[model samples]
Target chain A: MKLKIWLSLATISVFFVGNTAFANEAEETVTPDEELYDTSILIEETELALTEEQMERALLLDEFANDRLSEIEATIEEGNIEEAEQLIEQYEEYLERLESELEESEEEQEASEEETNEEDNEVERVELPDSDDNDENEQGEDSDEENQEESAEDQDKSEEELRESAKQRTIILQALLEREDLPEQAKAGIAKALENQKRAEENYLRAKTEKAVSDEDEDEQEQEKEEEETELQEEREEEAAEQVEEENDNEAVVKAEQKQNKAEKKQQKAEEKAEKKQQKAAEKAEKAERKAEEKIEKAEEKANKAKEKAQEKQKKAEEKAQEEQEKAEEKNEKKQAKKAQENRQKEEKKNGKPNHQ
Target chain B: MKRAMMITCLFLLCACGQGEDATNDDNNSGQTEAVLYENDVFQIEEIDGWSVDQEATAEQEQNVIFSNGTTRLIVSIVSKEQTIDTLKKDVQSSFSKKVELIEDDENYIALLTNRKENIRGDVYFHQGSEHQLIFTFMTPEQHYQESKNQINAFNEGITIF
Candidate 1:
């Protein structure tokens, strides 16, 4: 019996635990009306704060503004005019912020574009020092074209998106304003919100129109600049071509002059060589003639010497012959005298003694 | 029989505790804490009255920003090798020149005032093993002290992966 009582107590405890769990679960479920709108706004603000790009932020703001409008409509449908009025005020504030943001974004974009232009100009100045102005201008035009294409594509896409969103919001607001069952208290707030929306739309349209005009003006300016650049380029090309032609002509003249000078120098050298050859030949001939004359003179002198020697030999032989003849005659006369003296006997002895003496 | 009575009383006490917990949960119904962001390097959650800035988070690869009214909490994970000295230097350099070192410990904390902007920031540096986590809480100078709890709560919600 005690065990049975224990089991019954345990059962009762389990039932109490189960009941508590169910109660907690029921309390956890929350309805949309009970949802914290303030948190939603905080979330929206947080999202906006986090967005770094202006166009993206504008788009987010547009989305949030639409959310507010939907909330206002829901509140109005629920007969909560006070809440609807509050949302309408919030909506107006959102619209104001959106407008300011869009304006700020546009200004920032313009400022950034100006900064890019300045930077490009600086780059052109820095990079193209020795280059021709035409080349520099062409480079600048190329960079400008690239930047414009990129900026135009992005700006056009974003602007188109914003314009579409604005139009959609305007239509939604108008439809809401046209609701027949809207409470009198909510009607004024909605009308005021609608007016604010229209004003924002008008501002957007005006800005877009101005942007279009400005773009047209920029296109015209770019076209004119391009034309000027092309003309300058053409003139520069013509000048370069002319300079090349002149350089070629001057080079040809210099080459011809050089050729003539070379030919003259070659002819002069050949003439000098011919003159030297003639002078050498003349000198050789004169030396041969002088050698021949000296040989002739030497031969004549040799012949004269030979003749004089022969004459001297002949004279010497004659002188010798005369001496022999004289000697013979003397001998004969001495012999005859000796004979005659012998004939005279004693007179021959005396003649012989005189002869010995 | 006494044991059974004691067991029943214990169960009754547990039930009451659960009911009280449920009441507390009801009180904090819409203000539930949730994981606001997660990545390969870290995870962070939304604190009470603070919401995550999705755009700012998406803009930077490893950075997140949480905002509440005029106060903002910026959390960034730097995938760089860092020591205490470098972390201190980073903290000092990350803020304005007028930033003062308020607390120096394992985590470096700094207080910076931008007089021109009328803003004040309480910056904290947490050095991890392979990465450094920087948390910057900024608000108007007037509300700097009032936003301390939010800053602390945000700090508590950060988890480095």
Candidate 2:
């Protein structure tokens, strides 16, 4: 048994020691100056090829650009100006790729928006004559509008994030340029990169301004079109009213008076129907409120009943415990009395025996 | 019985200690090998001390890198269109002017030395029917000879289809 316990402890200690060593090995990292650094670059290139999305690719390119910047700084610190220059060139290439990718993504988003607008226009053209179908169409339009709003918000958020990243890059580059120990060759590269970053930022602002202008123009055009449509509708209504007046002029006075009275009766009937509908809706609301109140009351009553049952159970348990305690006390008292009686008998026997002696 | 138990405990502890020492020796000498990467083209194993550079492998499926301390072994599988002459040109263009073609035949091996970086590389190219495999083992110039056995062990684990 002791041997088994010792073996188990030895095994456990060995296991823990092995695991700690493995963990330490796993936690080790390779830095840029190491021989495996080129491997790291190869892996990064492979990942870049596999990434499919434009915005994600652009973000990744930005990350790689930052990595190159750090590598350049490290190389410069080690007095390896040639490698720093090479890293700077690579950084420039990454920046160029990132700019192109951002542009492509923005253009794609705009194209998709245009396509959605065209689709909405087509849907609007296919209007149904039935009023119920028109209501459904209106709801569909509302959902489409909501989707457009969400997409617009997403686009704004992405653009803002990109701008923020660009700003950050600029700040880093500016700081690097200001460093007193920076080599002349590296300083030139950083200055050029900083300029490129500023240009990219300006391009983003330009695109945003252009989009805003275009949206304003579209809104203005839509408003003008709506005003024109309303004007035409008013003109058509005026024409119909003139025709009705001419018909009245041609018809007898009594007939026209009868037509007017029939129209007034129809309006009154429509008003009565509307009032009844409102009253029915109000009654339904009241019924719902009463039903909710009854449900709450029922739930409360059930809770009270459960509480009462639990209290009664607790009381019964308490009474049973008290009875058990009292029984134990009575038993203890009887045992003590029996012991005292036996002692008294012994004492009497002793006295009688001594007297006989 | 108590003395026997104490003796058994000491024996167990000594055995465990020896086992640990053996494992450490194996890790240092690159004696143990395990399959580190595999695909349709080929399968390769890494030496005991070496670890796969996961960040690199995660990015590209065509290539994998194993590193042991400052030593690195990079394995890449490319198209068979890469000829020995093209491989030579690639080596010449990438490496320093001091790089030498030490071996030439069915397998082209180049020794690359970069004085500035104080690193040396032994690059090997193997062409199979469907794919061409390139292995580049790099280490500090001072330790290049010491890493030869590890490199050889790593190469022996490669089985190409």
Candidate 3:
């Protein structure tokens, strides 16, 4: 029972793990917006291997060629031109054999690739989900009918994407191979790879151009995002400035209003004080006028009384002073006449400018 | 068998034709064991194909091998303050393949051999200035240790020009 339970647990665990693994695989296989390159092609079409005997022969031939070349070089150095030429011929012959063998190997690889491709196509047709299989078959049948229309649309899109990617890869490879530090042999290989890559890129571009134009949505989105961020930053800055302005405005308005209130109160107080001063001034003026009028009246009364008394006294004194006044007037007239004559004489004598005084 | 013998015979004949033929000529030729150049500032001569390039300073007498593809020059300079045994040991270690210490004492010194037999005469050490030269012949191993007086005399007689 324990064993059974353990087996059950193990099986359950495996099932869960397997499911998880399958989920991951499915996730990897099904990109939301991209087509996955199936590795099944490469797996089915394994690289062709050279036959052991052929490899050995090729190695031997290479060695032989190298030895012969060395011998030729030495012989030429030693002034054996004829011997060197013979060795050169042998080297060429061996090289030709090597070329043939290489060609054969390449052919074999092509054959293998074709066979694998066929097998892969067969498997692919059958390996899809039931719905996909039915759909694919239906698509195959309808491909004749609707392929032209569908392909025109699909091709344009695929081609553009493919071309863009190929261009990028070619540029990358070219950049890689162009490095100065790469070894001579590696540089040569890289050059060849670059050439092939360029060709592939060209083909991909050609195909892509034939298809629908690739959507610029991602690029647009990125640009939009950048623009949004910029706009948002600008908005934030505007908001910040507005907020600051508002705060300043609020502060200034409150302060201004408070100051205005203070000024109004001051003005009102000044007005009230002015009005009170005017009233007090009026009252003072009135009191002063009254006091003045009383004094004037009193003085006038006294004057009147005094005048009467003076008149009485003057009447008595005038009779006595009349003679003195006449005498004083005559004396004053004489003194004034003398003074005027003296002043005129002194001004005339002092200066012409003093004549005006 | 016959063909093998013929090839061997041909090889031997070629070798024999190339062997040194100066055994008696060296003795009769009024040749100094060591020839000096530049008024005796430098000296160089072959001993059993072992070439010596010798130079001298105020403090020591230096012997060198002018053999070896390498530009390296090995100098064995002797000073009055140093011992012959030490000098000999030094020379032996330095010129293990090309030179050997034949005789060494307070009053006399000699070096035997100067070149490696199997390494082809491609590599050697030699000493000379543009103005001076000194040459000393390499002594055979068998006679080097035996002829001490003769070796010393040879070394002592070594002069420039």
Candidate 4:
């Protein structure tokens, strides 16, 4: 009886949670991509994604931006031509701000993506020395770093999504602007929308140039990591050689040590040669494969060209045949008509009807 | 090897020879076509199988009308006395709602109109320093497909010297 009561409680709680999920989804009036011009969800997502400073610039790009352009067009449609110029200029600033925001976000994303890419590079090059225990320890440490890095990557993905949303909005605005059959009054609004997009693009390029100067820091970090790895390996080699040197107490021992060092150097040279040969072989195979692919593509292109030429020739031949047949048919009809006219003339003469008539 | 090459050349020549014959036939078809009308005043060079109306009694009639059976070309000289807007308004009213203003500007305004009885006319209004000219070419819908190129050529051939 107690078990049954516990089961009933669990079932009731599950039903309540399911109902809550459905109710939450039903609250949204429009889903993404339902309407190209509708920006409800995208605006909400963007507002969430942007920081406090960025939010200020993003305000100009609100869904209410369409209202100002619509108002300008309404004024123009009312035949207020003189005020239209001033209205267009006033609306241009808001569009400029929105465009700059788009650009700023894009530039910031590019800079942040470069930094993440460098970190990924450093993580990739973190291969431990030839020791299993060291490798295992380093692997565990790398996994933890990777988990932390994943959150940073998640931030980048969100930034990318925001940029994509901005691009979609810009494209939709431009498409609405390109309607030629639209009235001149309505054109003012479309033009303003386009102007905003253009201003955004320009602002992005300007900002990208300034941000590009800072991208050198990520490159320097990558170089520093490579230097650190090389220094660490050199230190390990020196420590091993020092241990061997400390044991050299007599002449025979020193000579044995020198011989051992010479043998080791010879093995290292042979290993380097083997590695070079293997790399060259791989390169040669890749080159030959590429050449073979190119040759096949060239053969296919030649065959296609020849086929097209032959088809064109055949088409021309058929057209000529058709025209010749038409000409023969026309000539035959003309001859038959002439002959029938002669027969009618003979009959008319026999009946004594005047040929002149 | 030489014999094989000769055979291949012959085969290709035969394939393309039909095109040459068609081209020759096309040239012959046009060679038989003779000119019928040439006008200097309304700045027309030549027209095939068409003649200017030489029987109009009214001297004040500012129109030079060309005819080939049912098809007609009527050129009205405006003398820059009226604005292009007036001409636009006049055509709009004459053709009513279905008149499409294809090209509209200060120097040139062209209108295409489809009227009752399957008749369609292409009207061009050209502006010059001394005079404005309106040319209306009217044809039936059946004849339009064949005569469109001829009409375009006639319009292009007119020089206002």
Per-prediction DockQ comes to 0.02, 0.02, 0.01, 0.00
> Mind giving the per-residue lDDT tens digits that candidate 3 earns over A35-89?
1111111111111111133332343344334434444444545655555455556
Tens digits of per-residue lDDT for model 2, A27-127: 33223555345545664453454345677567667767766776776678788888888888888899999999988987888888789878878887877
* lDDT (C-alpha) at residue A81 in model 1: 76
Instruction: Judge the docking of candidate 2 as incorrect, acceptable, medium or high.
Output: incorrect
RMSD of each: 56.1, 29.8, 52.8, 35.4
Q: In each prediction, how many residue pairs overlap at the backbone (N, C-alpha, C within less than 3 A)?
A: 1, 1, 33, 1
Any runs in candidate 3 off by more than 4 Å, and if so which? A1-60, A128-357, B1-161
TM-score of every candidate = 0.41, 0.45, 0.17, 0.28
The global C-alpha lDDT for each of the candidates, from Candidate 1 onward, is 0.67, 0.70, 0.44, 0.57
Q: Give the native contact fraction of candidate 2.
A: 0.02
Ranking by TM-score: 2, 1, 4, 3
Off by over 4 Å in 4: A1-51, A55-91, A99-196, A202-227, A249-357, B1-161
| Superior candidate under lDDT, 3 versus 4 | 4
TM-score value, chain A, candidate 1: 0.51
Better of 1 and 4 by TM-score: 1
**Native contacts recovered, each model:** 0.00, 0.02, 0.00, 0.00
Question: Residue-wise lDDT of candidate 1 within A1-357, one digit each (tens)?
Answer: 999999999999999999999876433322125322232343345435545667766766776676677677667778877877887888888888888888988888888878876986687567655767768677767987887888768877877877787677766766665565777667777767766766666666556655655655566557757866786697588657756876767677776676578669758866886696578656755665565556556645754564465457657868888899999999999999998866676665667654432
Alpha-carbon shift of residue A155 in model 1 (angstroms)? 3.6
Candidate 2 lands at a TM-score of: 0.45
lDDT, residue A350, candidate 1: 62
The candidate, 1 or 3, that scores higher on TM-score is 1
